[model samples]
Target chain A: MIRDITIGQYLPGNSVLHRLDARMKAVLTFFFIIVIFLCKNFWSLGLMIAFTLLFTAISKVPLRMMLKSLKPIFVILIFTAVLNIFYTDGGRELFGFWKLSVTDKGLYTAGFMVIRIICLITGSSLLTYTTTPTLLTDAIERLLSPLKVFKIQVNTLAMMMTLALRFIPTLIEETDRIMNAQKARGADLESGGFIKRAKALIPILIPLFVSAFRRAYELAFAMECRCYRGGEGRTRMKQMKLKARDLGAAFLVAALFCGVFFLNYRFKALI
Target chain B: MNENIIEFNNVSFAYDSEIVNAPAVVKNVTLSIKRGSFVAVLGHNGSGKSTLAKLCNAILVPQTGKVTVNGMDTADNGLTFDIRRTVGMVFQNPDNQIVATVVEDDVAFGPENLGVEPKEIRRRVDEALKSVGMYDYRLFEPHKLSGGQKQRVAIAGITAMQTECIVLDEPTAMLDPRGRLEVMETVKRLNRELGITVVFITHFMNEATQADRVLVMDDGGIILDGTPKEVFSHKEIIIDAGLDLPAAAEFSDMLISDGFNLPDGILTAEECIEAIYAEAKKRGVC
Candidate 1:
């Protein structure tokens, strides 16, 4: 059941989007979020939505999995929509009650908020679904390399991120194994009151923590054995290069940004 | 470039530096591992065999005398990296050692750390993976691999570094029977084909039988060191070292004690079988 949580999971593929340099994808994803928020009307949002869907289709990410990524934020989406409807009061009142009212503007704003949230989740999900976790770490490290000028240990931080990402599934599997072993020995982990359940987890958590620390020590030793000395003077095996496709994608994003800016201005002038 | 890849000059080490009176984990160990030789270190748990492996790579610098690898003293701070690169160490836990998610990337890790060129690293990664018979699974996640395959990948990680020697501290300890065989065969092939010096630290007597030389440790010191035949011949010392003999040796000992003719220091099942067959033929039972 824990494995079904695929929000941050990468589905391996050879699609053009998947092959894009991770740094390019990361930068575009950031700018894409900005474009999503810069819109003031349905026209710009529609453009962004179309762009997301087209990219999603080209990337070959399963639409079902993409929707699953939005499941956790579904409640927040509704909350935002409800909050906008109840709080915002503006042009063309549609209905009214004591201390509460719904207006045409409120309805429009609520719908716009929902669409924005959906676009945000889907756009970011596309990034993860296309790029492997290691590539993502490399992309983040490369993008954040400028912080080195501020005396930041960018390489160390990036190496830590890469290790963390590499170990997530491993730790998850370990946790699952521990849970099963505890359950087989008559540990009541599933059936209990809240406090009782939390207490039952102690048996699993203790060993898990102990093993995790041991693993950390062993991994550190192994890393040292491989001559890893603080990542100084280290060269990367996989180098990220910006290719023609990345430039084309960047060009498309720039055009989208310009379109959103124009539409946001044009719509405001009319309003 | 030295014929002797690793040398320990009266080395002593301990885990807790605060305990000055505590016995060292590796006590006054003096040894040299020749280049392109397969040497097995045998001892039960807590016999300081693992500590010996660590000392070779400078992971745990000896507290007393000096340990050197490829003529670089492990005690020298700046030489630590070079020592490690010259003598790679693979631990028992496969999952803990593999740093990268992808097999090929993990294999490239050591070379990358050593500052190899990207293209050369790629070539080495592929070559290492192919050597370990995991080339087809290069892009696969490490966690998804079998225990044996994961250990192979770890070995590949060392191989790609172009290390002259690899110290496997019970690499097959966590593996199943098949996994153990797979890892053992891989290590042997690496030694025989590539002429990479191998220091296989294991408690398994059968494993020790395969090595060119076996060293038995007890109480943090080497008690016996010789070829498999010479080492297994002294049954009392092996038992005193907290180790059992290979099954063939024990069986041969039993047969000889039962007034049957059998060769001493039998180290393999096939050898035992052949001895039994010859005895039967001599008695006209065949």
Candidate 2:
């Protein structure tokens, strides 16, 4: 049951998307999100959808996995689409009953919104699906290095993130062990009601927290023994370098932005 | 250069030194570890062995006396980094010591902290992992490895720093028998091939028999310090310190007491077997 979590799910591969520099991939993902929001009319939305599909195909992440990423947001999608169909105004009315009405414009807007959201999700998921979490954090640290000018400890924050990511699986396994130990000791964690279950978790959480603190103390000592003195003179082993592929990706994203702007200007607003 | 990689000059430490009379965990200990020697410290729980390991790298400065690593005083804050660089430490808990998800990244952590160039770090990381027999596991996540494998990775992390001496505080205590053997073999190889000094702190008597020297600690003081055979020969001191002699030594001692001819200071099963066979042949019994 604990293994169902798909957060930070990265599929390893040697595909083009996987080989792209993580920093550039992150920047491109941000630009893709903005372009998706700027999309207007069927032409712009279609372009965005095509861009997402191409990215997914190049990423080599299975199509089933891409659709699985959307499963968790199914409720939100249905809720938003239903609201858009029932409440949106403009264009010719399609049907009406007792002050509730649906119009062609409403249908158009619902379809556009759903497609826009799907494109946005897929574009960002492609980035994570290709880049490992370690590389992603490295990219973030480099991207945010400028913040160091404000006297902020960007390196320290990034180190904390890296440590946290490294320990997630370890801590999850610890939690599983603790839970089973508790169960063996006659702790009824599963059959309880909502409040009872939460209360029952107190036993597990207290021990978990204690062990986590112990781990942190030991890790700090280990790090110090390795001559870790903050990030002053630290050099990274995996250095991020932008290659020709990054430039090509940047150009393609620029073209995507321009296409969306042209489509928005050429077509009338749907909602 | 001094022959000693680490020297403890009457060092004593207390976690809470502010109290009027806090008991020192390490009590007036004066010792020197020779360069490139494998020394195993044997002590039961609360025997200050862990505190001594911490002092090797300046993780815990001596409150009363002085501790030096490679001629640098551990108490001096300016020399702490250099001291730690010369003497790396591997703690008991492997899970807590590993700081990276991927094995190679974790191995590179020590060199990265020392500001080694990216190219050098990569080369050293590969070399260290290969030396520990973990080169193939470099790209593997640490969590997926066995307990013994994780401990080896932790050792590789220290090796990448190219430290002259390594102080491990019960690194194999949490491991199973197989895991303990794996760690011991890896440590032995590092010491034998790379000439890395090892100050292994453990309670397992058999593990200590493999070391060139052994120090038995009790009540925060060294009870015996000599070659493994000499130390194990003092059976009373070992038993009084809440410890046990290695199985081979104990069996040999029992045989000697039962009117059988057996050699003294037998520390390995093979040695005991050979002695017993010699005795039997002398008597024409087999």
Candidate 3:
């Protein structure tokens, strides 16, 4: 059960999308999301879907992974479909059964909504799947650097995010170790009542809490010994750079956004 | 070499709640360790050897006594940082002790803590990694490295700090056999080749054989203190304290009692083989 939990999943690749500046990718993703929502009719939506598929292809992320991500949201899709099918009111009524009615408008609304949602998820997942977590946090910090005006301590925040991302795997491993150790001691974690289940968790929690505090203490001591007083005058080995391709990709995204938004508006007018 | 680089004067430490059903961990322990030497502290589990190592660097101060490193009192708040800088510690778990994801970064961490200039930090990191034979792993993520490699990186972290002495608390306890050998070799090289003072804490008697001196503790008391040969000679006392001898040592002991002309105090396979061959030659059997 513990092995199945994938934290901050990052798949390494040498694809063009992976090579782009993280900050640009993050910003482009925002603009891309807006484009998806603005696209309404089939022509504009078709254009956006083509664009998403193109990026997805370039990223080299498998289609199966995208599908797996949507697995959890299948319930949401079904719920929305059901709600729209019987409750939606409009367009020529197709059938009537006991107080429930199915309309042509309901069928169309449900179909478009599900498709839109699936595209939205599949499109944004590209950013996370292709980019490393460290790079993603680095991009976030660089993009939010303007908040330094409010004394945000951007480097500290980014460092925290990077460390947090780095430690997620470590903590998961530790949690597994603690759970196994407790189990070896005959502490039942499964097949127990509500109160018993809670009681069983204490053995795992105590050691984990102790270990966490111990790690923090060691880290603090280590930092102090290194004279690390918090990111002042610190230079990075890998300086974040913005390449020509990064800007080119952002511009391409912007152009797509403008084209889709206007085309959708025109398509809505025709309908 | 100075006979006393570290002097603990009339030291006694009870746990904070010692008066209330709490046992004292180190009781009235007073000793001095020589400078420019490799010393191994031997004890069974819960023998207070770890607590003593902690005191050497001011990680824990004595409740009733004083520890002085090169004449500087460790308990003095003004000198605590200096004392720590003087004596670095490598812990049991190499996985947790490493501060950076990358090997070089982890090695550089200790130097960085010293507020060294960036250029010096780079130089020290490279030198330390090279000394530990991990220069090639500089770019590797620490978690991907094997147990021995991670421990070596942790040692490099302490080495880069340029501490005069290193105190390792069971550095090989979690390691496999090969990992244990690699770490022990590295520890010896740092001590003998680099002339750095080494205080190794371990339950492995074979590891203790590599050191210049051995200090054995039993039940919060100093049971035996001498060179390896002198200490291991009191074999009965150590075993009585519930610590087993290294395999080679045990084999040598059995052979000795069986009147096989084998020499005493064999600690490693190489040593045992050398002694057995010499005996064969003496008996004209080989």
Question: Candidate 3: which stretches are off by over 4 Å?
Answer: A1-6, A40-44, A81-112, A137-238, A261-271, B1-10, B17-23, B27-36, B68-73, B76-86, B99-146, B160-162, B192-195, B219-226, B233-268
Best by DockQ: 2
DockQ of each: 0.72, 0.75, 0.18
Q: Where is model 1 chain A poorest over a 10-residue stretch in terms of lDDT? A: A1-10
lDDT, model 2: 0.92
Relative to the true structure, candidate 3 reaches a TM of: 0.79
lDDT of each residue in B221-286, candidate 1, tens digit only: 999999999999899999987789898889888899999988777899999999999999999999
Rate residue A182 of model 3 by lDDT.
82
B1-286, model 2: which lDDT tens digit per residue? Answer: 9999999999989988889789989999999999999999999999989888888888889888999888899999999889989999998989999998789999999999999999999999999999999999999888888999999999999999999999999999999999999999999999999999999999999999999999999988998999998998888889999999899998998999999988787999999999999999999999
Interface DockQ of candidate 1: 0.72
lDDT leaderboard ranking = 2, 1, 3
Give one digit per residue, the lDDT tens place, for model 3 in B1-286.
4567788888866677547756888878899988779999999998999889888887788887899998889889888768878788888887666655557766776665566777788888888988999999998766667899889988998998888888898999999999999999998999888888999999998899888899999888899999888888898998988898878889988998999988777887799989989998999999
What candidate 1 gets wrong by more than 4 Å, as runs, is: A1-7, A265-271, B282-286
Judging by TM-score, tell me the better candidate of 2 and 3.
2
Cα DockQ of the candidate 3 complex = 0.18
The TM-scores, one per candidate, come to: 0.94, 0.96, 0.79
Question: Would you list the C-alpha lDDT of every candidate in the order shown?
Answer: 0.90, 0.92, 0.81
Model 2: residues >4 Å from true position, as ranges?
A1-7
Candidate 1: TM-score, chain B only: 0.97
Clashing pairs in 1: none
Ranking by TM-score: 2, 1, 3
The better candidate by lDDT, 2 or 3, is 2
